[model samples]
Target: MERNAIILAAGKSDKFAPFTYEKPKGLFCVKGDVLIERQIEQLQEAGVMDIYVVVGYMKEKFFYLEQKYGVKLLVNNQFGKKGNLYSLYVARNYLKNTYICCADHYFPANPYLNDNPENLSYRACTYLSGKFREFAIDYSDAKVITGFNVGGRDGMAMVGHAYMNEGFSSVFRQFLENEINDFGVSDLFWEEFYAGHQRSLTFYMKEYQAGEIYEFENIDDLREFDSEFLMNVDSDIITNICNTLGCVPNDITDINAINAGLTNVSFSFQCGGEKYVYRHPGGTSGNLIDRTTELFAQEKAGKLGIDESVINMDLSGWKISHYIHNARNCNLEESDEQLETIMDYLHRIHSVDVASEKNVKVFDNVAEANKLMEMASMIKGNLKREFAVLIEKIDILYDAVRADAKRLGYGLVLCHNDVYEPNFIYDSEGKVYLVDWEYAGMNYAANDVGSIICRYDFADCQIERYFRAYIGHELTDDERRFYYAYIPISAYYFFCWGLYKGSIGENDGFFFLSSYRNMIRFIDVALESYGIVI
Candidate 1:
């Protein structure tokens, strides 16, 4: 009876954040041995010598396993954007008589066995009372799994390791092949895929004693198990965070990656019983953000009661903000209920006195972008023609915008500067708060309007509607022209920003194309409005 194992080491879970940023959880050295390597040894001892390691999210680091353990590596390239079931889907052909295992789990003793090679089973452990968090299992009197739950207590909890006989794998392969193209199915894990169809299937629970199946759910668990956790001593992200917070690395716990912004990488962590988000500067971020100005603007927005509390921010673009829990970003669809509050916040934000901070407007951004365009070797090689045309019209576009902006009779003031959908958060109290002040500065309030419009690609009527709500007035010709002029300027600035970001390998795929196309479209419209050209 020949059997093989599929070790899922692909998707990177942020539950083990700073530790798993560069080194995947599979590679973590747990209790004097790497996690996945220990699993490999156990599987080999169980006579499952022929193994396939599904690798992604730093797959190159697993290349040594092929030489060291003689295991085949099946690479899942879309690992960052896809879920774990896709990993199994890639290894679907080899699921026969297979032990399906997760790479990050640990066991004090060998759990892999070939004695029950013909049985379809999932490993589980008892969680008695007091409300457990893992997937709880319900089984029939014959030891067959009948159902599973997410928030149940006093029952079997899934340990994420399973085995499938040839008959089960044969049918599962069909499910995998059929569901590969199914929408929303790729988001679930293989266990979840099975759980969805549990009524039609039978999986006997291989029950383990409580605490036998080990998973380090948090930093405290790892440190309690091993005081000399390398995440504290070796990780620079931890060192910088602790040094700034004036605490040791062990004080930080429950680290998770937040929604990664285009300008910054953020992660949520708990320290001193306070949860906060740490923003790490992303690629090309240093040149893009002036942190001094950002600090001033963010502090001002906070004072206005329209932003989260900032814990610490420095000149290097590293920042910590008080995390807003139970909140979601706006959809920015034309019909959203949150739009009125968001519009009110924008107007309130523009009233701040920013006389002390340096003003950064669309003109300044365009000048900075021109430098990025020339230095971008990729763009210089391919987009030279389009770049040349936009470069030639920069002066025309700026001059038109500047003249129209003068018609407003009020000078530039502070603004959120980048009023995209994700920058606005509606907390549980139904309060709309602005965030991500990296681009904030003393810019025309028109820039905010330009930002929301260009970022969301708003139509003419929707634009008119929001602008009407923003100003609370009828369409004044000068005000409309002023905003229309910013459309081209903002679009061009975004296009060049994309050029710079693209050169640094932060390729914003569709954003770059659409920004360039919109820049051309609005540039022509601005010129036509000025009655300068055809």
Candidate 2:
């Protein structure tokens, strides 16, 4: 007999707020496709033409889904008061010779049912973890005779889309008839009925790993599941999913060719008279969404302080942020005043009480320098041997200098961990905007000044003058020593970061190598200034 599939999607999913606040759990997407869409596709793949969705929460949203996907919708009126069994009972009329499944549980499409009825009757089960106290199973002959406290256990064979012969309705009806005076169906009904029937069977499925059955019980789980799914989704599938979200671009425009340090491809585009940057962090970083949101918040707060316009934010599975014009770069030699302005801007950003409230932690420079030493040790060939040795010397210098700074008790101040030229923006009004707040946090402020001096070709006098202005005092002998000391430390960090990027095929090794060479030159000059051997 041909089979039909019924999906139960009625729960309120209170645990997944903000994420599930506006949409039902069935509409949750992995990669680009919604769970309901995946479920439908799986059913279609299984050769089931007639599909029924039992929906209660956000039922109207599925109306279009039913029409678009050609599936029938069954409303569960008592969904709020009762549970899954009650929803099943309401849809019982459609259950004759049907396959029942839960809307939230994801499984691969496997159409071939066991031909042996005895074997087909089996239930999937597993031992529960200690923390998952709600899970229980009553079993016999590889089939579940009863189940209870089903939360947090993969123990109960998912029954939403279980195959049922014509006689299955009689069994289901009998189970419902014996329901306790309590309004909801008890967990014992299925066990009692299956045990009463001599033909029932059960089977334990393979344990779910990376690709299987990621049950979403909380927002964190949902985010993690989406990130993993996005990483594995095929390109064509991503296109379809983007189309479903109503944000797919008609034609690629201004590809930027610059990665925003995300997993997926992103580009700036104009849609509906509004300009925005559409980012597809396909799978590279799991925290891309959170990072994007934080950036938006920081930008808003920063703009307010400077009397600049607020940037509009539209975050999603794909990140979309405000598109800003590229600012002019100030000439390091001709624009000494501009350089000082930039330093003052940096000082203002560092002075702002942003990092402390956010609880941001800057990466340890000493630890980073040590990592370079380790990476140098791992190099195997003569061709890169000089570069490795150079890194080792730089690491040693950084360690000695950082130890001195700590001993002197130079108070930690907010520092921009990366103070490279590209990260500085000169607005048309000649105001300097320090962008890319990724590494902003509390640290030795000289580290920030040191990073800029090492990376950019600024005049030594201008550099000293800018530092003096920023800290509101002429540099003491110890302060100058500390700043010069951290120059190699910053260089060691950049070199290591570049190596790490290269190891991961990110194409940034050459930039780091250039910076490393510059640091060596700075080290010689600093030693001469300190009256130490060059």
Candidate 2: where are CA atoms >4 Å away? 1-266, 278-320, 354-358, 372-396, 403-409, 427-431, 457-474, 524-534
The lDDT values for all models are 0.75, 0.57
Predicted structure 1, TM vs. truth = 0.65
For model 2, residues 1-534, the per-residue Cα lDDT tens digits are: 577777788877766433343467777766667777887887777677798888887888789876788998889776666656766676777866666667776655343333234424333334444445333554545443444344554454333234565566566656665663344344333433344443533323322233344456664565555645433333442353345345543332232333434134444545455555544443324421245433543464365352132343233444445545665666645766866766676666556554335544545775755554455445522324556556555555655566667788865555567676665656656666555544555667778777776665456686676577556688777777777777776776676666555544455533576567667767655555545552
Ten contiguous residues with the weakest lDDT in model 1 = 354-363
Candidate 1 per-residue lDDT, tens place, 72-151, comes to: 99999868767788999999989888888888888888887545745655555555566778778888787788887776
Off by over 4 Å in 1: 80-82, 113-133, 148-151, 195-202, 216-233, 253-259, 268-277, 282-484, 494-531
Which candidate's TM-score is highest? 1
